[model samples]
Target: MEKEDLKLLQQKVTKLRAEGKYKETIEACYHLLKSGKECNDFKSILTAHINHAASYYCIGDTEEAFNSIEAYVEVCSRFGDEADLLHQYNVLFLLYEYNKDFAKAKATLENCIGLGKKLEKYNIVSNGYSNISHVLMEEGNYGAALEAGQKGLEASKLHKPASPILELRVKLNIAKAYLELNHFHASKALINEMIHDPILESFIREKSQCYHLQGSWYRKQKIFKEAFDSLTVAKELVESYRDLYLLKSIQEERCQLCEQMEDVQLGYRVQKEYISLLNEINKQELALTALKLEIKHSMSDFKRKANTDFLTGIFNRSYLETTSKEWLEQASVKDENIVCILFDIDNFKIINDQYGHLFGDEVIKQVSNACSKTMKENELFARYGGDEFVVLVRGASLESGKKRAEEMRGIIGNVKIEMGGNSVSITSSMGVTDNLDGKVRSFQELFHHADLGLYEAKKSGKNNVCVKLADKE
Candidate 1:
């Protein structure tokens, strides 16, 4: 091959490498090495393979990088060169770490460490230990990282040209491992050491991550003010990157703060309005209830006027007879006991003769009140005719209902009515009959039996209760 052709190939390789096209640069390097008879030798060939593998590693093509590294190692073994073997180990360790192959990465580092010690290359040992510690820490091997970081720190300090960058990186990683292990004080001490170092000032992103870690630690400590300050600083440093999740976090915090402030300002106003609205609702409810009650009372008075006898103030004959039939039919269906009692103003003609009709009406009203007063809640007291009254008792036997009738008869006989300034007493004769026992086909049958009893009560004596005896078939 011609020297000019090789030189042109070299120029192309240099250009590709400068442009960070490592894969293309490696291909160009290989072409140049193969074309040059002088350059196509053991050492040059191995260098080309290493360059190719490094590019593959940088591009995250680890499979190709591993294949290239294996080929490079075979070539080195063929040449039997141990000079730059530690560099090869370093590259392989990086590739393994990138691939998340922690075991292989650790093993490569161990081999690098041994060779570096033998060669007395403090720089190599320090960098190798740092990388090992980094992988261990990433893999959550805190104890291993701590040990490796300590050894790396010592090696870094002993290097002729001390690498503060490597030292800081190792210390930071060890601090992170301490934090992971919940050794806060040790972690904080290591962090403080790194913070004091002048080199940390140049690494903006690393510094931001450190602040974020500190903020989190403070938050866990319940030191809100310190945490807020640290987080504020961290956010300012990273805001230019426009990280959506972190921006959302900051915005959510701000939203909560704003809501709290608004709540503080408006809480009392809302409470006052709530109380006022409640009072207004109660007032409206009371007014509505009173209006409902007034309407009910007016309707009840209208119903009474329509259905009641004016003189006696009891239900008129028509209403009484209609209601009695409905009660009897319902009671018969339910197989319930029921009784009907009829009462008449005894010797009504004599009363009219003794006093005026007005006085007679007064006597009727007094008698009606006496009967109504004696009636139970389930009993209906109604004036059935001019001088007759009726009572319907639900769920009562004939005997018990006769007793109730007698009680009413006695009450009426004792009550005095004002008749032209003449206080006069009135007596009523009552008759009772069981409607259920008869299973009366009609309300007329109940009234017929009760009327017979009434006639007998007047015949035997005035103001008495008489039960109608069931007739033989």
Candidate 2:
């Protein structure tokens, strides 16, 4: 597929989702994913995965939604780039909040807000704060909810193109805080403003929200008939979108209103619907928890595959360089020493020539396994290149680093490979570098000093250990 075709498909899916045509959206996203996969367009694939998950969720297929989202995470972690992990987390917050895990929901929103600020996506930041306010309202922190909602309102205005819907949403959230705090006049004013807006007539979701809040206001004011009318409108609007969360809320409120009116038959009917919705939600909540645990293991494996060497089953150089920067910076801040151990198999090239490449590969794997087995605490191990491995440690001194190097040397010496009914002994030359004088400013410097030490070790007969310090020669 062409890039323009992919972009057009994505826009179609987004439009369908915005219009609440979830079934159609799902179909569109499926086609998008298929095309993206055929063309190896990971960004399109990622968009399809997340959209498909959300569409499935809206249609009440919790299991399928979870499964789809797991695939999304697996793809993102595997590809490393073209991953909107922030958006993934943003979507998960809805599920988390629905499941009543407010803390986790808040944490995910916090992540979204941080990413949004970094990316200069003020709309996302506003949406996050607005959601945080809603969560706070759910937890009965009306004061804090008001503060967050105001912040969301402020943020929504920061975007260049502006988002009218987001501004309204933030205001609605603020009204929720007002209603919960018994500031009836304040809440009623906002609710009335949205309910009468002609522009919102086509926005079923927003209109439903306005009616939902209006109904709440009526219910609190003891105007049961008006409350019933408004809530009925909300229920009808929400049902069109299959927004189970909102549908459930409307049903629960309707049930309460029936009870307040003392209409026994009406109350029983509404109660039954509410109970059914609750049962389905409860079942989905359990399924979500189980799927998350299941996906955790899969995601771990996916991440390992992305970062690990294909043949040696150890961390690869790309992962090493990317991760070491963070570790080195943290170690520097803590005034801790960083140690680097570099080594290579003895006569690895000659072994490949004499015994064949197969034996050489086996030697590398066995040696890596041996060295990894007795790895020092906090050590970062990786295959730096062909037949060469590096281990990094933080908060370790020069003496301990040398001792660790010796242990790795011994472990490599013990690795015996069998070839043609004969056992082959392998040894490795080791070079260790440490921040002995706190001058090992970066991973590059650390690796350079370690390379120097390895040269010395090789000169002293390959099966030896040599230690060097940064800038000390």
Q: Any idea what lDDT model 1 has?
A: 0.73
Model 1 per-residue lDDT at 363: 78
Winning candidate number (lDDT): 2
**Candidate 1, pairs of clashing residues:** none
TM-score between model 2 and native: 0.62
Report the C-alpha lDDT of model 1 over 1-473, residue by residue, as the tens digit.
65566666656765776677764666565565455435555555565667667766655557767887888888777673666597589788888888788899899999998998988888888888888888887887889888888898898888787677767766766777777778889988876666667776787766666776666666656566666567667667766554444544543443333344455444454345445545665675576466445534653665577578988777887678778888878876887778888988888988888776777787788788767766678988888877888888888888888888888877887888765577777788888887765367467888898999999999998778889954433
Q: Ten consecutive residues with minimal summed lDDT in candidate 1?
A: 251-260
What tens digits encode model 2's per-residue C-alpha lDDT throughout 61-174? 667677787888888887745228776887688667767899999998988888888888899899999999989988999999999999998999998797678788888998
Q: What stretches of model 2 exceed 4 Å from their correct place?
A: 1-201, 210-223, 330-336, 393-400, 459-461, 467-469
Best by TM-score: 2
Q: Give the Cα error of residue 164 in candidate 2, in Å.
A: 9.6
Model 1 vs truth, CA RMSD = 39.5
